[model samples]
Target chain A: MDLLRFITAGSVDDGKSTLIGRLLYDSKSILADQLAALEKQSKNKEDGEIDLALLTDGLRAEREQGITIDVAYKYFSTPRRKFIIADAPGHIQYTRNMVTGASNASLIIILVDARNGVVEQTRRHSIIASLLNIPHVVVAINKMDLVDYSQDRYNNIVIDYAEIARTLGLKDVTYLPISALKGDNIVEKSTSIPWYEGPALLELLETVQLEKDIDLERGRLGVQYVIRPQSNDLDLHDYRGYAGKIASGIYRKGDKITVLPAGLTSRIKTIEVGGKEVDEAFAPQSVVVQLEDDIDISRGDLLVNGDHLPQVEQEFEVLLCWMDTKTLAAGNKYLVQLGSRTVRGLVKEIEYKVDVNTLERQPAPAQVGLNDIVKATIRTATPLPFDRYTDLSVGGGVILIDETSYVTVGACMVQ
Target chain B: MSKEHNYQLDYLDQLESEAIHILREVAGQFERPALLFSGGKDSITLVHLALKAFRPGKFPFPLVHIDTGHNFPEALDFRDALADSIGEKLIVRKVEDTIQKRQLTEPGGKFASRNALQTFTLLDTIEEFGFDACIGGARRDEEKARAKERIFSVRDEFGGWDPKRQRPELWNIYNGRIRKGENVRAFPISNWTELDIWNYIRREKIDLPSIYFSHDREVIDFEGQWVAVSPFIRLDATDVVETRRVRYRTVGDMTCTAAVESSASGIDDIIREITATRTSERGETRIDDKVSEAAMEDRKKNGYF
Candidate 1:
């Protein structure tokens, strides 16, 4: 079965964990032992109700404080598809965590409580999903039970979310009205809302079109590890291979390729999967690419089709999200890790800080602190190969680390 | 749609790419690294990913297995054979050896298991070799604490994991940088679920320990689960041993690893069983996790892989 990776974003009381638990519980994904354990850990035994929030609240602090501070990954499967859920906590200070969780997600579920429609956090999450280029969005209007499963309430909230999604340029938005606590529209259709005719949340998740999300133009492969045989082993004696996952596009043997930053050229002599030789490899396949000529390539080097070369620049602009407690100031040195490459870099300029909820800009911000998303220019000590985030996302994502603390302090999208 | 641009990747391919990328990072980032191989299906899959990451070449890192001295004989045999076949250096640090050095003391009882003591040997071996990175096969779907883990997790000088202080991994760009006296525990297959592993194993045709396949084994019913009677496990007078067609969902030290009643003779059969499995791989097999709800979490925070 194929995989669909999605993220769920909502405020602490939006029932993010409850929604996930309902999906798992209703689908029979939660095992007997797990359910038993959940019962044992239930805080309300007198009511004979199992606390679903305690399932994802694995951390002691999260259980005691009744809030998720970090990204919690969850996995489940139905017959049609397997799922990987990156459940990001929707808090203003934890914006970095949401970005981290949604970075690789193909789809995002922005939960909006029916009791409080069109909240600031909802807009913030939608903006992040759009900025991250998530291919799909689900504006799940949750807690319909409180609204008496009212059709007008659900429709009105969806209309509000639709305007925000359109303004943010979010693609493929789907809306669902559900009561996570009562399992309404979660696994089975809720008869209480007879006006609704959409598929259940589980059905939609299992049948979503996630395959078309990958970009397959301009073959890009960052040389992560240059494989050379230790000895005259088997049939691969003296064989040298450029090993990495195809970032995008399709590549084949005999295709002429260019080595970025070095401006050297070579032909793809062989493509092997470590099991056997193959004629061609496409985007996201981790295969060994052997060149006709022994070119000088190492980790951090990029190999692309000669016809499709990415920008090799020492200075570039990025939409940066500062993730550390330490404020980021201009002229402060840091390390930029982009794909397989890590190079020393410094902030050239801070263009602006974005207020995601209002879509306003704090122009020429003097400094950026924890969870602040800003636009900035950076100059690296050496040239690196990268694409614009819109054209090719896998190659454009970068992370900034502190020089001394060795902490990933920021995430950058090459602009 | 043109086939050229419409080449969609299956979930397995995507997971493979992820695992390969992590293995490459381990090779590119660290000075001294090793893969923690338990000879289980997860570790076996990890070895294959590392092999693909640096094939036609010897792995830059060695295979490090913290032998708990009570491992299944088949697991050790497979581990040694795999290391030899790949021509990679294999390092074995035994809990028994650590016990002899007085660095660890064995628990005494009918229910005593050495599974928890493997951590002491592991930390000692890591310090001895000064390996900056330890690639493991710990998946998040197995337990609760693992669900919130970063792909590249940081450990302190004492080898303790501080979950609250973990470095955030934003995307494919993993920060493998750590200071001296500190190390990183990398989990490439963190996103892969139990079914995903079984499917990938079938796809790749990876050879696993024979214990994973169903066979007649002498097992005793212990607390509603079947525990294989082995030399390492001393049974009580009340324990009754009987032959059963069983297979292990997870392979660890024989003393603590339980088996499930099954007729899954091959990968396809195993996949079907796993597809309909009610309990998780560890939930059904690992006795160590039965100690407490946060057993794995406590062990992980204490530097156990």
Candidate 2:
């Protein structure tokens, strides 16, 4: 079976944790001991009913506050696919946590309360899904039981969200109506909503098309580390290999390649995956490639097919997400790490900050604080090969680390 | 999609590649790194991945083990043999020596566990070598607190983990940058579950310690779980020691780690047993975590790996 990584975003009032708990419970992923523990904790509730939301609130503070503070990863598998859920908090202040969770997700499940259809929280989450370039979107309208399982309510919500989808330029959006608390339209088709003809949430998750997400056209590999035995043995003497995971596309033995920044050309002599020689290697596969000629390739160097080379420049524009408590201003210097390369970078200028809730480009702020997303220009000390975040996320996403504190302060997506 | 263009990988391959990538990041970023080895199935799987990651070349870091002295003889024997077979450097530090030097008080109970004291020796070892990063076999599916941990979890100089201060880990990029005195605990297999590890082991044909398989042992029943009767625990007169065919699901200090009654003698049987089991890996085997709901989280905040 294959794997699917997704994120669930909704505020505490929208039943985000309840949806995840229901997914695990209905899929039989929760064991007997875990259920017993949940039952014990549910006694403290006012209603004396089992609170499934207790499953994802792992931290003590989160349990006390009855809210998700940070992103917690949960795992479950079915016959066809293995699922990794990044359950992130949806409060306004927790936008950074949501971005961190949505960065690696191929799909996103945005929960919208049926009582309040297409509210501000829903728009904010959709904006993030678009910013991170999530391929699939599942807008689960939760709490249909409260709405009396009315088909008209579901249709109105879908119509309201279609406008937001268009304004944000979100593609491949899917809508579903369900009651996460009452177990309606989750694992099994609900008899209550007979007018709805769509499959259950579990079936849609299993059958989502993800193979097209992997780009096999432009092969890219960033050299993470070089392996050299340098031993005196006759068979092992003078062996060197460039080791990294293919950022995108496919590579084969005898293929002509070029090392970026230096623009050195060579032919692939051999390809090894898991220490075994393979004829060809594709995207996302970690392999060791040996060049026919001895070239001075080191870490931070990019290798790509000779035909399609990424842009190598020292200056670029990016949408920066400030993550640290310290404010960021123009002329601030930090370490920018893109893929395997880390270089000195300066925030040249802050053009404008995008209002997440309204999707409007506001005036440039003098200083950007935590959870602020801004469009800015950055200049690196050395030329680096990179693609746009919209085109190839693996090569374009970067993180900024503080010089003295050594903390990751910002996440930048190349525009 | 075309027939020859079937570029999809099995779940195992995807997990393996991701792990190797993280391992390589540690090698590329840290000036001095070490792999925390405990002679368990998870760490053994890590060793296998390390071999695949840096074969035909020596590993960038040595294998370090903080011996709690309360370990089973079988696991210690296997630890020595595995390091010897790989022809790599293995550094062993004893918690017994730390307790003696520091004059620390040991917990007194029927099951006196040294699991908590392993952190002191680990911190001392880190200081002695100035290791900038230590790769472990911790998986998120094992516990709730671990599920929120990052792949490159940054620790303070005293080796404390602050969950709220975790760096934003995006895509496959990991930030291994830390201050001089601080170190990172890198978990390459953070995404792998217990079932994933077993399936990977079965596919790779990786050899493990004999305790992982079924064998006849004298065990004591504690709170509906089977605890091995070893010299580390206090045996009372009222306690009944019976011979039962059992195997360990997790390897830790002999006093804290429990065993399950099973007849799974091979990898296939163990996989089948785990598939049909109702309890989690930690729920079934780890007795130390039953102290409270946030037991693991509390320990992790105080520098317990």
| Number of the top-ranking candidate, with TM-score as the measure | 2
Which residue ranges in model 2 land beyond 4 Å of their true spot? A43-48, B1-3
- Model 1, which residues run further than 4 Å from truth? A45-47, A233-237, A306-308, B1-5
Determine which window of 10 residues in candidate 1 chain B has minimal summed lDDT: B1-10
Error of 1 at B196 (Å): 1.6
Where does the lowest 10-residue lDDT sum fall in candidate 2 chain A?
Answer: A41-50
Q: Pick the candidate with the highest DockQ.
A: 2
**Per-candidate TM-score, chain A:** 0.97, 0.98
Q: How many backbone clashes does candidate 1 have?
A: 0
What number of clashing residue pairs does each candidate have, in the order they appear?
0, 0
What is candidate 2's lDDT per residue for A88-188, written digit by digit as tens?
99998999999999999999999999999998899999999999999999999999999999889999999999999998889999999999988888999
**CAPRI level of candidate 2:** high
Best by lDDT: 2
